[model samples]
Target: MTPRARLGRLLNDALHRVMAEDDSVFVLGGDVADPQGGTFKITAGLAKAYPSRVFGTPVGGAAVLGVANGLALTGEKAIVEIPSGGSVAQSFDQILTMSSRLVSMYGRTLPIHLVVRCLVGSGQGDGAAHGRSPQRHFLGVPDLHLFELSPVHDPGEQLAAAIGLGRPSVFFEPRSLYGRYPLTPRAEPGVEVTGPFGGSRWMRLVVGAGAGGPSGVAAEVTVFCTGGTVARSVRAARALAATGVTVQLFVPSRLFPFDLEPVTGFVGPGSLVSVVDDGPGPAGWAGAVAAALATRLWGTLRKAPVLLASAASVVPAARELEDRVVISSTDIVRRLVRELETP
Candidate 1:
């Protein structure tokens, strides 16, 4: 078997490729320089290779993003790294009020290329402050694209795409997935890029769709998940298959500017659609999808769409307590089973 590629290494490689090709691209974040190489080591060796382009900044999110915005304005592509997703709140003004609104404010489209990368979500017992799912808050914001790194896809491909977007964007890296080693071949550097809307995929399937349901249609369960949640949901979907349940699992790369087109086929009148998110319950990205699909599909759905996300509480550091707050594969399986068993 081929050795799996660690996500961190893929990101490091992507940065090297981008910076080498574009002298205008710069990387800024706390402790991103040599030896430190960033808090998570995702920027490892970047400072050494691109000494002038990659530099560490003082520990202030707002100031860091402010610098990035300034660089973007001057035709330079800036990739700003926030140590944790929670810290992005500190720079909300810089991103939402300043960078994102620049083109609209100027009354014309300007080349404001910026990529804000941060470690997001919870699963590790990192406690409240460090473990936060901030992706939900940025959804639907204009001119500011949102993306999350997936263990299933090539991180290098994703990073290159984000940089090439030439728009203000946020790329989320789930803290727990930094070490994930996906056994996949590396994609051709800069060959195929998805930009903001990075497509979706169906991981599992059931033959002939319907099993049995109240609506006389098959009791098909369709699950939509993103980012770190995709891996866990894959497990749950496979477990459901073992139990003789028909399950369809979908993973979307881009969170904002969401496209419902690709996922329409899997859902039907009798389909039980469930969205799994690692963020806050209901109000997160999963909730947005559930609400939109529910409104659009309306009376056609066998049951109302469901959102499976973290509980409405701070993520605890203790493993047992943390499990209650953060969503898991077991939680997904349990929820689907309960819904399927219901009359």
Candidate 2:
């Protein structure tokens, strides 16, 4: 892969490959079928390659999802894109009415597979509308599942694997990670990248020792984080390593139907697990993970692990203000040193 490689484009490539292999698979959305190939150019060239199957749509979320719902009803698979996370609020009724019932009613062979894709998270100066990650709204929604694309994992495999399950699902990629996650081979020889979870790995150990290869320093802190924050958490691990406090970085790929295995298995008597979230407050992903981990590991933990997320407030558009709201590597480093490791 070249230095300019991006997860979005690679995902488009995977979509193209899968579409070519399966005639029933089709994709449509605003800017998605354009020569520009999406806001980040992830879907480039697919329209021309599969002109019959890949096409563009109007900006209306309901209208776009409506078309997807139609395609799914007709024994066809559809991958629909909505621009941002908040944009999804408009399609809630459509999703609730249409997504899963159609799939199960129609049976597995003719499964109505739908992949709802959207861009989420804050980059640098994104405003309130564009910056918000809206998955939290669907936290308890029935049948509709939520997943994230981590920069540390392969985008195509994540996309295909989620779609292969033959159900309706929502998968979002963080805006900030598109440019930051390298597309080329690992610059560091010792590092490896794998998709969210293949098996019992649903609660995956993304970086550090469980990431395969030589196990370096033994893990002292079980660090939990999701997409967009994985990079930051990894850096925190590295920084803590320098100061003699080793941390094991854990990234969970799937959000709904929370996986307890790796985290439960990792923690033992006197062990600590830290959940580092990017977005604000004492809730959302961090809260859900903390609750689940605490329930299963209740008897095993030394103390309740610390959860570091954005401050309980609106995320700011200004770079400095935004930085203050979310967790960072420095936040992870200092928190580990003061809260977990230090006597």
Candidate 3:
């Protein structure tokens, strides 16, 4: 039997493996050392493994990022973790004007390898202040590789890819998906999936959301999503399938540097394309994707891509109120159904 582990555990193991293989790689974050590990325990045993390299910082995201910038400038790989989703904004300048721009500012002669890992999303009663999905803040930023981890994908591979970019990156870890794992053998059945991302970082799910392979259906609607909204989006796709709508659901691991080639081949004119995200529209990753699609498929797509995202309001702590702000599976189903049904 294949061993199974929670996504969080996989990420922890990945960090251990990464640090073991690369001596230059070290971690810095608040409460990320022994005992506490991290708010999510992603860096559980790093301090014990590499005492000199791993350091726990004060509860200041900006300070951690600033130090990481200095470390990267010295040609060392630094993984800075922002323990809370809402705290990520505190390091905005360090990420935008400093780490991401250092290489270009220095005449592109040197490369700064830094990874800013943020814990994003609501649902733990942490309230609007601590449960915001701030990926939108860094989306489309030049020289910054933006990635959102999916529970169904391999965390080790995703983390390795982000670190291997040889440039600055913002990796969003969805708090809601820490307990999920990849699909089982039964989920695959007879389905076969092939893609440019090696079929691991992304998936070609079938109806019912039991994905380990692709659905050989001529899709009239194509949905692209990532992060915490993946499972919900899949459920929405499954519901849409029940209504006889062919929905092609693609969950990509990387958000920025989004490869539209795979999308372009599957989606065409007269097809309804939708992007589901936890952030608000027109400024978030969904909006960025929609804009890219519109440009790439100029005059080719009949309808503008739809963005199914969170409401443009502070995420409320109340579960009911949070539902209103965060786009739900039912919301996806309803929105896609309406879009498809409309003349």
Candidate 4:
């Protein structure tokens, strides 16, 4: 099946699971009840399936989140899907103060399973607000879990895995990738799917052992990337391989609580590293990984790795402009060659 179809099926299964497991698990969003399905069609059939539990909330994001928080505290599970990044901005305060803070403050122990599914990245002319990677905003929040999903060929697996987690997760689906990539047969039902809120996964070295000269010949360069940027990094790796530069591309499936064990092991003394992100430079996961590497693994590195992120600016509305701001495969290939050639 197509990737979008797989994603839709996955989401549908997740919704059904949530409903069957907990009567309190309700869906609240801005015009998510019908037709448009909150822009991305993630919640397309939810309202029809559970009419009483599904609600079309007012445009006020803060109120919607606040209400969800209240319900969660009272032993309810809420899936709040915002229309776009722009709409979610209105709920920041509620997200930070109420939903995030409750777990630590009162030990409320309430599982506020927030599945914030929004379209991010470019190519839809969604404008600055709609086409933003706002996942950076919730990075530092103590009690919340942030996750960004870039399902290249399996939406059903992605959605099932994302929603199966019974905690607050910031699920960011790339707008540009929707309905584009196809789903592989690898995406099947009944597979265990992890929640995005849990933590980031380690980067597995994809390079073949013999291909890297000798078995023990460690990689001198490490490339860290996430989301669509991971695909770009893969392309860059292929290009670098053609030029006789053997580089390792580490793709983190999760964005928060940056997993260091696998990454640190791959990076050693004098290793050249670079991070590629699709969002603004400063607040993206790249910065977080860089800081961690500096503090925890600096002694092992030869030089400070460079961070290749989107230019510090709002996402552009036009397709061409958006493409420029966002990282592409060509951009990755270019950056890798330049960095390796310079020093």
Q: Candidate 1 — which residues are off by over 4 angstroms?
A: 1-3, 183-219
By TM-score, the best candidate is 3
Ranking by TM-score: 3, 1, 2, 4
TM-scores for all candidates: the values are 0.89, 0.87, 0.92, 0.83
lDDT of 1 by residue, 1-343 (tens): 1235677777778888889999999999899988999988888899988899997998999999989999998899999989887788998889889889875677778888899998888778788888888888888888888888876566777788778887899999997777876522242211111212225332322322342322323537888788788668767876786777666555565677777765564476687889898987878789998998898777877688878988889889898899888889999999989988885
Model 4 whole-model lDDT (C-alpha atoms)? 0.66
lDDT of model 3 at position 149: 79
Could you give candidate 4's per-residue lDDT for residues 6-99 as a string of tens digits? Answer: 4444555666666767677788888778776666776777788788998898889889988888877776777888777766889889888777
Where is the poorest 10-residue window by lDDT in model 1? Answer: 188-197
Better of 1 and 4 by lDDT: 1
C-alpha-based local distance difference test score of model 3: 0.79
Q: How close is candidate 1 to the true structure, as a TM-score?
A: 0.89
List residue ranges in candidate 3 displaced over 4 A.
1-3, 184-202, 208-215, 298-302
| Per-residue lDDT of model 2, residues 146-192, tens digit only | 77887656677677766776667788778777766452226433234
Note each model's CA RMSD in angstroms: 5.3, 3.2, 2.7, 4.7
Winner on lDDT (3 vs 4):
3
Decreasing lDDT order of the candidates: 3, 1, 2, 4
TM-score of 4: 0.83
Find the 10 residues in a row with the least total lDDT in model 3: 191-200
lDDT of each: 0.77, 0.70, 0.79, 0.66
